[model samples]
Each structure stands twice: as structure tokens, then as C-alpha cells.
Target: MARKVYGISGMHCASCAAIIEKRLTAIEGVRHAEVNFATEKATVELDSRAPSLDSINDRLRPLGYLLLDETHDQGAAESETAHQATPKEREEAKELRKNRNTVRLALPSAILMVALMLYGMLFRPLPHTLYNPLAMILATIILFGPGRTFLRGVASFLRYGAATMDTLVGLGTATAYGYSAAITLFPPVRDFLGAGTHTYFDTTIIVIGFVLSGKYLESRSKTRTGETIEKLIGLQTKSALLVRDGKETLVDVSEVRRGSLLRVKPGAVIPVDGIIAAGDGTIDESAVSGEPVPVDKGPGDSVTGGTINRRGSFTFTAMQVGSKTMLSRIIAMVEEAQGSRAPIQNLADRVAAVFVPVVLVLALLDLLLWLTLGTRFMGFTEALPLALNSFIAILVIACPCALGLATPTAIIVGVGRGAENGILIRNAEALEKLAVADTVVFDKTGTVTTGRPAVTDIVALDTGTAASRILQLAASVERLSEHPLAGAIVEAAERDGTELLECSQFRSEEGLGVSALVEGREVRVRKPTAGESARPEAAALLEEGKTVAVLEREGRAIAILALADTIKENARSAVEALKRQGIQTVMITGDRAETAEHIAREAGIDTVISGVLPAGKAERIANLQQEGRTVAMVGDGINDAPALAVADAGIAMATGTDIAIAAAGVTILKGDVGKVPLAIGLSRATLRVVKRNLFWAFFYNILAIPLAGGAFYPIFGLLLHPALAGTAMAGSSLSVVASSLWLKRMKIG
Candidate 1:
């Protein structure tokens, strides 16, 4: 199945989101649909013959949803977002204004209602004709003023024959106000019905007031979750010094394009990803890679956007601009991850899909049972009052607001916190699964050991050829080959200040290594075969697990050169941390058994799967999965891509190649092996918050719904008031959002 993601608008609650998912999956070509209410986005799965996005969006418009073009937003992101504020920021400001309007009305009305109730208690109550009019004015002000949002929600949501939290709030308050108006203005109706002379103006006023107050608090918490994105967007450089034909002119950063030469001065952020064409600088790339040490970059070295130049100056040709830059992709990936659904959210979606309608049915039953049965025991007047209060309470208390907010709120806060710590989570599901991973498989090179190989030991066997001379000749010949070992040999010769002689007739074998003519002698550098491996010098080097190569001249071995990659400093401690957390650690390598075991032992990994080719790496991961293990593959090389995709969770170092990062579910910046344990720890912490939110929502509904329905009225003589029910319902949603926001206080990777 093919997948597509789109920003969504007009979703007010979980039921509103679930409604869209239902309608989209009902479409002919769409296979599955998931609409996340918190992030206001949809992830859809489609088949080979899926309808166009435009056609599908047309279907959704009638259902009160719009599929926004996120691709357009991303394309214009680096320019428009930097110069102007994002559309989401504008929406947040608008929402805050609306909340303020509700608060201004609700506060005064609440104070006036309390004053009137106190007046009635302290002295003789005003006559029905006078007091009822005062109450009517207050209720009217609260309902249509602060309650307009719910009224609008009712019109937009209920037209499609669906219901949400807004539907229940609007319908319950409307029912109380309308019924009170009829009884107050036309008293004959109440007398003829013989129920009561009292009007429910207080119920109408208090319910909307409490609900609006809860919304005000919720908006504040949500704003805190977006701070990370705001900080990241603010990091983009505003302007650049464009170098055109040897003349430099100041211009906006957005004007930068591919191949445009730009002069970056000391203490200025690089405008975009580019390569230095002239001069050099000390660049502080901590903003992009989270490595604090400034790196010395010279001509031909690449510099990323948003990085600060600490010293010197250089002119670089821009290679990537706008949304193609690194910062923009990170922002996009973070947004996508926050909008994604975890597997645990399936339960919440299934419940929310049918929650409001089920609550409506239960509320109707509550009214009918009280009116028919309770009227006989207590007569018409008293029972009628119980029936009305119970009916309204059931509607207000069982709104499903908290249930809808359970998972997505936690995911948003978790993803935002991860971004601040330089860990990028691609989707919510990865965080969930990685938290419970049983085994973590690490690629030996670049993950646990330093990928940069260095010459460890050089032994001269032929008395005439000195150790320095052997290295100089070998480095000269190997320099012609483009291999990691070749680079190590060249660097060793350069470090020792050895003068390398020129080589002729340079030729290379695939596995046997390079051969050339140096100083009129046939110089051959190759790995030892089975017979040659038995020699004293070769055997000693192989036992130590170094990459052993022989330098041969005139068909006689002159020297044995061994290269070894150093183990990462934190690798052993990282492995120990995983073990302490009840996770098994294994090493996967293409090296010989001796070499693989040496690196594994150094990294505190007891299990070493050696001699596995790149293609076979995925097979090993699949075999581990077949054994019922949740395996997480950690690597920083292109060969790890397939294995990373095949594992239960893929953790890639941002220092690695792009393909590895693209394939992995989680990417850690700074290339520190210690970050592996931190990533898993952060996932576990986030999952705990999600679970706590879900548990509270489910527990609140189960315990509160029956009490609001007056289930214990006969035995305990207890009935909850409609006003208190609305306040509790509002508090439930606020509590769930607050629980998610609490994730910010926890330590992140």
C-alpha cells in the first residue's frame, strides 16, 4: 500500500477526527485512514487505483473537513516561514482571542449568579416575577455569548448526522435554556403539566461557564508543546552576503539558490548547505549535529545551513536551499512524527468512533427511567425535577472529551521533547515499540568502533628495508586506490613526515589488494591467504584482530602493516546500560571472527555474529524476529540500511550516510554510542505518560457516568447536579492535556 500525509482542518474533537477516518476508509480506493486530533493531520493508506487527493478532499469537505496541502507548506517553508509566521501560529492566536472572549463573559456572569444566590439565602428572596427575570437575563448572556463556539460546533458537526463533545455541550445547554424560557414566560404550561414552578436558568449559566474555563487552561498547555518548533524555526539565518562575480552584496537568505556563491563572515550563520570554494573557517555545527566542538573546515569541505562560523571567512556555493535544507527536513520530520498514531491509539480510536452516540442513547434511557418509574414513588413534582437534572448531567458528564485526548497529546509533547535533545523520532509507533525492545544489534564499524582506521603496528621483516621506508613505499602505492585502509596508510606516512616515492603500473585485485612497481621493484600489498597466514608476524597481528596486510617486494615479504579502528569511548558503558535495563546486546560485522570478537569484547558485547555480508544482515535480523525477539538495529553505514528497515526498530546516527538515516525509525545526532541507551529510556518515559493518560480517561468515564445517571439514587440517596457534572467533564480533558505536558519535565535523549 502507498501512504500519504495531509494537514487537516476543522476537527474539534476525537469524534470529529474519527468521523473523517471512517469516511476516508469508506472511499473506493483508500485502504485505511487515521486522523490525529492533536496534530490536526491525517495519514492515509491507498491502493494501486486510489482516487486523486483532490477528489478525496472534495468528499471530505461535506463532512466538515479540509485536507490542506502540506507539501506546499513544506516547499515554501524555509522562505515564508522565516519571513512571516506560520499559519498554525495565526490559528493559535485566533483561538486564544476566542478563549478570552469566553472568559470575559463567563467570569462576570458567574460572579453575578453567586451574588444572587447569596442574596436569596441572606434575606427574603425576591418574588418569582422579579427574580426569574433577573436569572433569565444572566443565563441568556452566558449561553449565547460564551456558548457561541459550541453552538457553531453543533451546526457544523451535527449536520452530517454525527456527534462530538461539542454536540453534547450545545444540545444539553440548549435543552435547559429552552425549557426554562417556556416555564418562566408561560407559567400556564408548567401548571397544567403539574411538575414544578422552578426554572433551570442556573443550570444553563453554570454549565457553559465551567466548560469555557476548562478550554482556557487547555489552550495554555498546548502552546507550551510547540515551543521546540518555534525555537528551531527561529534558528534559520535571516540574511546572507551573496558573492556575484567577485562582488559581495547583502541579500535575504531566501534569495539563495543552488550554485549561488555566498560569503559567510565570522560569527554569522551559514545561509544554506554549501561547499567552501575558497578560504577556510572554524565552524560551530552544534545547532545541526549537536556536537559542541568547533570543526576546522577548509576548501572543498561542506557546511550546513543554520551553523555558525566561529572564525575566519569563506565563499561557498549553495547546494541546497528552501525546504531542501537540513533544518527544514528536521522540522518536517518532527511534525510528521507528532501527527502519527501509535499502535495503542487504536483502542482510543475504536472507542471514540462510537462514543458520543452511545452516550446519547444511555442519556435517553436515564431520562425515561426516571420519568416513568420515579414519578410513581415520589409523585409528579419531585420526580420531574430529578428526571431533568439527571438527563442534563448524563449528557454533560459523559461527553468523551478526555477519552479523545488520551494518546495524541502525549505523543506531541514526547516528540517535541525528543527534538530538543537531538533525537528525531520518525513516527509515534517507533517510540512505543522501541521502549520494549528485547535485543539491540549494533553494527561493529562506525557504531561501536570508530570508523576511522589508523595504522596500529608496522614490523619490518627484511633487514635492509627500514620500518619508515616500508610505510612510505606502501602508502605511495595504496594512495592510488580509493579504500578506507588506503587512506589510513597515506595518513600514517603524512603524520610521520616520511617522503613517499612514486609508483608505476598501479593495478588492484578485488580481494588480494594493490600491486605496483616502486623503485624498479615489483611492490605487492595484500592480505595473507591460509598458507601465508601461518607466518609468525601475520599470525601475531591476526590474533590481535588487526587488519593485517603484507608489503612484498621482489616476491619476498619486507614488512607487515596492521591497521585497527579504535573503540568508541562510551560504547562499553552504553552496552552495560542496555544490559542493566534487561536488554541483550549483540554485534554484527563483516570482519573475520578474530576481528569481530575483538571489537565486541572491547564494546562489552558477548554475542558476535561475524562474517555476515551486507545482504545477509537483513536475514539475520529477520531470523531474530522469528525467534520472538523485538530487535533494534543500530548502525551508521549504508550497508546497514536494509538491516535497519528489517529490524523491529532502526536507530541511525546522524553522522552516517543519508540512506541509513532515511531507513531508520530513530536518528540520533552527535554520533555518540551512549545516546543509544538514552533513546530507549526516553521512549519508555513517553510511553508511561501515554498509558497514564489513557488509564485516567477510561477510569473517569467508568466511575463518573453511572453516578451522573443517578444509578445510586435509590440505595445511597445521592444524585449529582448537572452544573457539577459539566465542571468535572471539563476538568477531565484539562487533566489529560496536563498529563501530556508533564512529559516536558522528564529527561529526554
Candidate 2:
């Protein structure tokens, strides 16, 4: 298997990541693909013999995804180049260059359009000499100058043995110009033939000008969609204060190597990924984690790159500098994601590929039918107008605007709605599958509980001390240790504001319990002693399922502090909601069976698969799929990666590590389980909209083609002019956009 990483652009949430994975997986020889919305990178494993980068790139472009690099090579090279640009300087220079180009093209195009309109309406009936010469000059500039891009696109399609909407417009306009030139150069030929005084130069110029204006508008709208990522990339600080030999010197963030000590001041963005070696302040991690709360940091806490330090001065050694920083990876991921394609976009592409050929055939049939009728009153010269009209009509009426808008427009609306609800959909396709999740498998520890242990009930064995008093002594002993369980016990004591007696020479045994000398007595907490029977009520409580942390003094049992994993406040409600949607909820955990059962019961989950390792979790997911269930795995730990990768769909919590996010298909930005249902609802809604859009796009062409081919002209004597054909084409494109915009207002369940 060959592994390649792509920095995807335009991934705003987890759904976007899913879309990329789905698209890449469809490629033959792609063994596996994983996309992380937060990181915005896709790691794809493929059989090198069946697929190539060129084919992948071609597939992604039409879906609006851009693959930044096939491997880490280009990103490493670019990081060195970016270090020299100074992020701020680079952004300003890029903006200036883009604005200059936009102004250069837009200004002249606007001027020529106005001049063409003025000449057509005001100077149309001038002497033939002036009219013909001026019209020729104006038409040439309008077609060749402002209209060059569309013409070039048309030419490219033809060169590739295909056709696009641009091909139709280019051909129709060029044909009009050809007819106009024929009339101008040989007026005597028309007079001798008694042909009507009709020339199409004005029509070609006006139509191409209007279409160009529309093209510009479409380009500007697309730019707006990408504005947020650009603003995000623009916020990075160009340089950081690097401390070397007791002197502080400014160096580019990319140039600050790992192991270099860096100084971060109040209100400055952290320039490199590093640990807080000496800081007593809070850092805003909202940009990276999507959390609104700022976390307090002290020595030994890891801080990510590109986050802002709100208050306090700190110096830290850089752990990950240059392109390895979280911010750089995110930027690269977003770039590649934007370039990734959706599966539905492929249908639009296939339809567009055949569109021009079908139109040409219909136009030919219309002309042949009219000729076979033997209407000699109008010669071939007189019949030419009808033929030209049919040709242009066929081209204009078959707009694939709705087909183009089907997936993207629905996704934009879905993502925006999801964001408002604290759910971020990373891509369009993920939203589609999420709407149909049949089974939701949750990781028990961090996913269900706050991932923290808490005191549930207490049991006293033989000692006369009350359970509360035993807990106080146990909490006192635990307060002197820094283990996770110790922290839990200490926090519980603090929460209850219980006075903790000082413990001397506390010794904590790994995987066991702590022992300490408290108040001139030796206190030890450990697992329950053999043959130590609990009181009747305490025994019943233990049987009802709770973890008992036993307390002892002088080798005799005192009391037991019962601990349990508490369910999140929203966990019950979220599970109930999933059940209402007919989804089966299961809990998978590496925790002991009793602990898993306790948590699962509290969360109201239907099934609990306990004592499972990462690989076992994956096996369970596969088993569910083998039984015909569409499974979605939700997790936040690195251990959950394999299971998440194997599930039909994987959802990683926002609190999850980079590896978990990289392995999963979706990343819940708010870390809210409720968003899982919301994502599912949005996916169903988006797919519905895609279906409707495609239906209208294809249906409109089916009905309009025959009418445009003059099917009703025999009875009504109605013929569509090339100008009206252009208008109808514009309307068809606009109709698709309008329908898609209407979807933005749709109420998603």
C-alpha cells in the first residue's frame, strides 16, 4: 500500500472530511482513506498500479477541492519559502496582486460593454459605411477582448473532444459573428438572393457581454465562500521573540527551530507549538478546539501554535516548529479539503459532458425535418434563420446550473445551519451518510462520562467510623498524590469543602492505592480485603453495581468510598433522541465490565460491549456491519482510532487528539453528542435538496429542448430568436441558483 497525504481546503466541519473520504474511497485501488476536518488533511492508502495523482487531482477540481501536496515534500519546501515571506507581508502582497488583476479586467470590460450598448441603440441607422465599419470594430473587441476567457474555455473543451456550456455560447456567438461578417462583406449577395436585411453582430456582442457579467458575478460569490479561511490564515504572527544566550531576538516562526526557547507576551499569539515551561496565565484555544472557554496553564502544560495568549508573560521551549505546527497543518488541510470532490458532483460532470452533443443532434434533426417538408417558398437562404435559431436555442436551453448547484448549495446551507446548532459539518457527503446512521457505538470513558471518577456510595466493613468520615480520611491521603484517581479523590473532597488532614510521607502504589500517615495514624486505601463482609445495606448497594474504594487504618478495614463514572448531563437525552430516530445505541469500552455497565445504565444505552481493547472494538463494529447495520462510532481517545477507522462512519469529539481526528470521518466541533443527530438530519436534508436540484436541472432540459427546436411553430408560427435563446439560457442557470438558495431557507429537522 502506498500512503499519500493531501492538505485539503474548504473543510469547515467534520462532514467535509467525510465527503473527502467517500470520494477518495470510490477510486479503484484505494485501500483506505482518512480525513480530519480539524487538521484538514487526508491520508490515503492506495494500490499504486490502479490510480495516479493526476487522475485524483482531475477528479477533485470540479468538486472545488484542491490537493496542496501529494506528499510532505512540497509542504516542507513551502515552509522554508514561507519563513522568508513573513506571514503578514505575504498576505498583504497577495491581496494587492489579486485586487490589481481584478481591477484591470473588470474596468475595461465594463467600459467596452457600455460603449457597445450606446453604439447599438444610438448609432444603429447611420450611413451603411459608418454603421458597418464601427459595428465590425466593436464586435471584434467585444468577442475577442472581454469574452476571451469563455472562448478559451470553449476551445479547450473542443480540443479535449468534449463540450461545455461555454462551448455552446462560444459556438452560437461565433456563428452570429460569421453571419454578420457575410452580410457586411457581400451585401450584393443578399440583395440578389432577396434575403431579409438581418445581421446578428449586435446580438452576439450583447449576449456575450451579459454572460460575461454573470460569469464575473459567479466568481465573486465563490470568493465570498472562501473568505473565512483566508481571514484565518491571515491572522498568524510573522515572527516570534526567540531567547538565545540570555538575549531575545525576533525570528520568523518557521525559522524558530525545535528546542529554542520563545517568549510569549500578553495578548500575543503563540508562534510555535510548545509547552508552557514558565507561565501562569490562560490561553484561548478556541481557534483550534472550537471551545469558548480559555484554559489556565502552568508549567508542563502543552500549548498549541496559533492560539492567542490573553494575559501573562511566559517563556517556553518550542516542541513543534515550522510546518509541523498545528496551525500550518490546519491551513494545509483546509486547502486540500476545498479541492476535494463530492460524489454527486460527478453526476453533474457526466451530464455536462454529454449535453453539447445531444443539443447538436436535436438541432440537426429540427433542420432536417424542416427541409424534408419541401417548403420551397422559403429557399435554403430564407430557411437559414430558422436553422440558426434552432441551433442557438438548443445550446441556450440546456443549462446545467441546477446540476452544478445540487450538492454544493445544499451543503453550504447544511453546514451553516449545523454551525448555528453547535454542530460543524466538515463536508457535504458526510452529511449525507450521517442522516441514515442505524447504529451509534460510543466509547464509554471520555465519550459518555465526563471521563472522571466520582464518589457514588460508601460502605463500612468492620470499623465504627461513618462512611463519610472514611471518605474524608481517604481523600486526605489521596490529596498528597498526583495520579488521575488521586486527583479525582482530592477534587471530590474540595468540592464538598471537607477539611483534609495533612498526610506525611504518602506512598502511592501503581495500579493499587495510596498509603500515608495521617493525624499520627497509618491510613491505607486498597481493594476490598478477602472475607470482609459489608453490612446488609452496604452489601446490597455493592450488588446494585458501584466501584468501592476501600479504606483501612492499622491493617483493619474502616469504610469503603464507592466510586462510579457519572454520565454527562446531556448523555441521557442524546441517547433518547437517537432511539427516537430508530438508531440502536451501544457502548464499547476498555473499562471493566461493572464500570461499563454502570455508565451504560445511567446513559440509557441499549447495549454494552465492555472490556474491549481498540482492536476488539473494531471487531465489534465489523460484526455489526456483518449483521447489516450501518454503524457510526463516536470516540475521543487515541485508542479509539482503529475502531473509528473500521466503522461505517466515525465521529471524533472536538476534545479528541489529532490522531483520533485524523482517523475518524467526522469531528464534532462542540463535543456535543446531540450534534450527531443534528448531523444526520442535515445529511438527509442535503441529499433531498440534491435530488430536487438534479431533477429540475434534468427535467427542464427534457421539456425545453423540443419546444426550442420549434415543435410548436407549425400551429403558432412562433420561433425563438437567438437573443431569446440566450435569455432563456440565462434564466435556466438563474433558476437553478434560485432553487438552491431556497434550500438555504429550508427548516432542517
Candidate 3:
């Protein structure tokens, strides 16, 4: 299957997304469709032989929507997005202008209607021949000039059979305008219904004016939410000093290809990701890593694009240019993460899917109830006007905008903040899961320690050769192995100027030790395992809190190489932080029980599970989960891949193996264990924001919908006007968006 993201044009609410997703998924060859209302995009998975774009567009045209293929001339699309004003900016500007124009046209009519209402209340009503025609003319201008958009939307709904915010607005406003026009033209029909009846031309103008003002505010607020991505893109310099044919020439950043040598000056941003070929400089990589400190760079060090060369000038061979640069990848990842939907969003989507149709039904019922039964309670003369006002209010006030905006707005803000802090959350689901992890399982080496062990002690027994000879022989055999402990033994031998003899017939036991033929004798080094033959000397060294590797000659133990790895500076504090949050921290290692316990104690871990082979790590995680714990495994090695995959959330350190990073859900660059708690803290904050948004959205509807339906009119003599309903509905959506944007201000410690 092939997956692609297509830009959608007419997604106004979450219900529109549901309709698009349902329709797209129903097509042949399309496996799945995920439509995001916040991003206005649809990610679709389809078989190799996919349906035609025309077919997809044909299905959407009736709904007054467009699905743009993102894969067409990506270079052109990027250039169009970056060089010129973005599509979003253009659309928002257009909306703002349109809203301002509508307000300009509607304000005069609204003023006239208010003056007419006040004149009637204070003095005798104006004659229908004079004031009624004036009101009808003003209303016609307002309806056609400022309210034409809603009218066009209604036309689409009638022709296409799709309902949206436009459907509700167009129906409500058209009803008020049409009723008033009838009352003005046919006075006898109005007199038969009620003697003191008046046309509602003011309501039509006020409703459109208020709804336009809300949309203008909403468009402005949404534009601010995209500043994170904008700032990131702005860091890339448009031009670069390209060194071609041994002569320097300034060229567009896009013109610089891979293998091109680019000269970066002090204070200038690097044009592309590359290796330093000549000169050295202090590079400020705060834009990419979020670390404010400048880093020293020398020849052969890799430099990323968009980082400023703070102090000296350098020439670099561009390795990854254009979209392949690290900066581009980061932007793309952030975009994907922001567009993703969490499991919690499913409830919001389900509610939004049926919200419009249900609101329509409720509005109809409100009108029917008032028309039939309202006369008995209120009076026959007031029933028609009350029912008309209630129907209009119910239609205009009941909006699904808040419900659709709740989840995606929060997710977009959360993902952008995480990217700025050097945490690349893969998806919304991973960030959501991180908030619930209670048990944190860590790999002992590289994760909790420095991962670089030194040979601290070497003890020789049985007068065969000097301790130096034992070290040389052990180093010779261990040099063939790539383990960290093996490097420690070899480094010790090399420091002592011991000549190592070549080893042959080498064999390594996974988690146990290694054996090889050194100097025509069988030499073996092993960390003692349970139920395995061991020496008393090895036990003594193990009890001393050292990683002991015993050497044997002809299957007899001879010497012990005791190594110790230094604990990381932040390991203890990271463990303490987790413990303070009531999270249990466990260290799983392949070393002996005594060594594992010692390291655990030094790192402030409460539990130590030791003597487990590399392959059995996942089993240990499963056993822990059996005790009803949500386990999050942090590891930085190939051996930890299985355990990482088995845990509820796998956090991979950037210093770790490629397989471990691939298996993990969250990857923390620079391998800082302290960031684990920070990720959790950020997740909790984002989850809190999401919950608050959902609750407020539901609560607003629950309270506003009933009031709009005139549920309190019988007892309180109150009725929510359609204009106020429009204002309240607009405020509800704006409030949800404002709440989501507030996540950026959170300081996750």
C-alpha cells in the first residue's frame, strides 16, 4: 500500500472531515482515510493501483470541497509555500478582508433597524407604507451584499445535499429575511397572524454581522498558532556562497547541490548539512537542538544547516541539501506530528460527525413545539413570532466548531512545543501514552551509566606469569570483541605498553563471556552466571561491586579483570524525579547480581534485575506488565530493542543503536536521561489542555443549546436572540482555540 497526504480546501468543521473520510474510505482501492479538520488535510492509504484523481475530485465537488494532490511537483509546491505567501496566509487575509467588508455593509442596516425598534418603543409605530419599504430595501442590501456567502453556501447544500456551518447560517438568515419581506409586501397576511407584528429585518443583518466578526477574530487567532513553523523556516538563509570551479559565487540556497563546497562566514547561517572540510568555528545550534550554548566545531565534524556560525569562518562539503537537510526533516516531522490524531480525539470526532444533523433536527423540533403548543402557554398572537425567533436561534447557536477544534488545536500546539525543546514526538498517540507510564525500566549500561568502562583492577592467581601477562593475554582475546568491557580491557593493556599476542578460534557466549586460543593456550574470560562453574576469586571480586571477567587456562580459572563503569551525572537525579512522581525505576542488566545492585544503588534506582541475557530482556518486561504496571523502557543499545518494543512506551537515546531507536516510540537527542521526566511532564500538560478543551466545548453546547431552544421562556420569560446566539457560538469556538494556544506558555520542568 502507498500512503499520501492531500490538502483539502473546504473543511469548515469536524463534520466535514467525517464526511470526507467516510466517502473516501468507501471508494475502491482506498484502504483508509484520515481527515484532519485542524490541518485541512487528508492522509489516505491505498493499494498500488489507486483510483484516479478525477474520481476522487468528482466525489468531493458536490460537497463544495477540493482535495489537492500534494505529490505533484513538490519542488514547485515548496517554492510556492516558502518564497511567496503561504496558502494559509492568503486564505486568512482574504477572509479578514471579506469580514471587514461585510461589517462595513451590515453596520448601517443594523443601525437603521435599531433606530426603528427604539422609535416604535418610545412613540407610535411608523406607517407600514413608509417604514416597512425602507426596512425591506435595507434588508435586501444586507442579505445580498454582506450575506451573499451564506446564501451561496445554502445553494451548494441544496444542490449537493451536504450540511455545514454555512448550511445553518444560510437557512436561519434566509428565513428571517424572507419572513420580513412577506410581512412588508402582504400586510393583511401579517394582520391575520397578529395585529402588532413587525418585520425582523434587523435580526437578519445583526446575525450576519456578528458571525462575520467572529470568523475574522478566529482567522487572526489561528494565524498565530502557525508561528512555530514559520520561525523554523525563516532560519534558512535564501542564498549561499557556493564554491564552484574553484571560484566563489553567490547562488540561491536551492541551487547548492550535494558535494558542493559552501563557504559559511561568521554570523551567517549554514546553507546545508555537511562535513567541515576546512577551518573551524563555534556554531550556535540553538535553532535545531534548542540548546542555547554554542558548540565548538573543527574539521571532520558534521554541521547541520540553519545553525549559525558564531565565531570563525568554515568551508563545508554539502552532504544533504534541499529537503533532505536535518532542518527540513525536523519541520516535516513536526508537521506530521501536529496533524496526527490521538485516541482521545475519537470521542470528539464521533460527536462532531452527528452534531450538524442533530442540531438541524433539534431546531426543527423547537420550531414545531413552539408553533403547536406555545399558544396555550404564551398566547395565540405571540406564538408565531416566538417560534420563529426560537427556530432561528437554535440553528444559528448550535455550532460544532468547538467540538472539532478541541483536539487538533491542542495537538498542534503540543507537538510544536515538543519540537522546540528537542523532543521529536513521533505521533499524538505516543505523546498521549507517555502521560500514563508508571513503571520506568532502564537498561543499565549507556542509559544509567556513562557506557564507557575502564579497567579498575586486575588480579592474578597461581604463579604462571606476572599480572601484566594475564592482562596482555586477556586484552588479546577481548580485542576481537566489540563490547564496551572488552574495549576497557584492551585500553588498559595498551596504556601499560603490553604487547598483545594474536588470538584465534574466538567464540563469544551471549551475556556470559568469551573464549579464544591465545599464545597456544585456551584463554577464557567470563562473567559468572547462575548454575555455572565459577572460581572463589571471581566471587570475591563480584562481591566488591566490580564487573568481574575471569580468565581461564585449560578450563582452569587463573585471573580476574574487574572493571567499573562511571555513573552518569544526572542518573541519580533522574531516578529521584521519577520516584518523586510515584514511578518505580528498575535497572535491567546482563551483569552479575552484585554488580547490578551496586550500579542501581549509585544511580538511585530502587529495583535491580540482573544476570539476564540480552535475549531475555523482553521477557522481564512482560513479567513486570503481568503485575499490572504500565511499563516505559529506556534503553540505548541493540540488546535492549526487544525490551523497548515490549514496554508500553519505549524512549530511545540518540546515542543508542539504530535498532533501538527504530523500536522506540520517543527518541531523545543527546541521550539525556533527565529528559524522560520532562517528556512525561510535557505529555501530562498537553493531556490536561486537551481535557479542559473537551470539557469546555461540551459544557458550552450543553448550556447554550438549551437556552437557544428557548427552554427557559415559560418560567423566566427569556428568549435568546439569534444575533446573540451567533455571537455566543463564535465565542465558543474562539475560546477552545485560545485554550489550545495557551499550551505554548507552559514551562515543563
What TM-score does each of the candidates earn? 0.86, 0.77, 0.83
**Candidate achieving higher lDDT, 1 or 3:** 1
lDDT of 3 by residue, 662-694 (tens): 888787766888888888878888999999999
> Would you list the rank order by lDDT, best first?
1, 3, 2
- Worst lDDT window (10 residues) for model 3? 76-85
Off by over 4 Å in 3: 72-100, 103-132, 244-246, 454-563
Best candidate according to lDDT:
1
The Cα error of candidate 1 at residue 429, in Å, is 1.9
Q: Where does candidate 1 clash, by residue pair? A: none
lDDT, model 3: 0.83
Query: What is the model-wide C-alpha lDDT for candidate 1?
Result: 0.84
Estimate, for each residue in 87-122, the C-alpha lDDT of model 2 and write its tens digit: 323433454454455445544544564575577578
- Per residue, candidate 1 scores C-alpha lDDT tens digits across 1-749 of 88878767666678888888888988999999888887777888899889888898798876667776555444356553364544544555776788887888886676666567678789866687887888889889888888876776667656777687777888788888888888888889878768565777878888888877777777776667666777777778778899987799998777778999999999988878899999999999776665678999999999988888999999999898988887778887888888889999989888888988898888889888888898888887888788888888988888676777888888888877787777889999998989889899999899998888989888888888888899998998998998889999999999999888888999999988899999888999898778667888778878878888889988988888999997898999999999888899999999899888888887889699999999999999999999999999999899999999999999998889999999999999767888898889889888998889999999998988899888999999989988889889888888998888888898653
lDDT of 1 at 716: 100
Best by the TM-score measure: 1
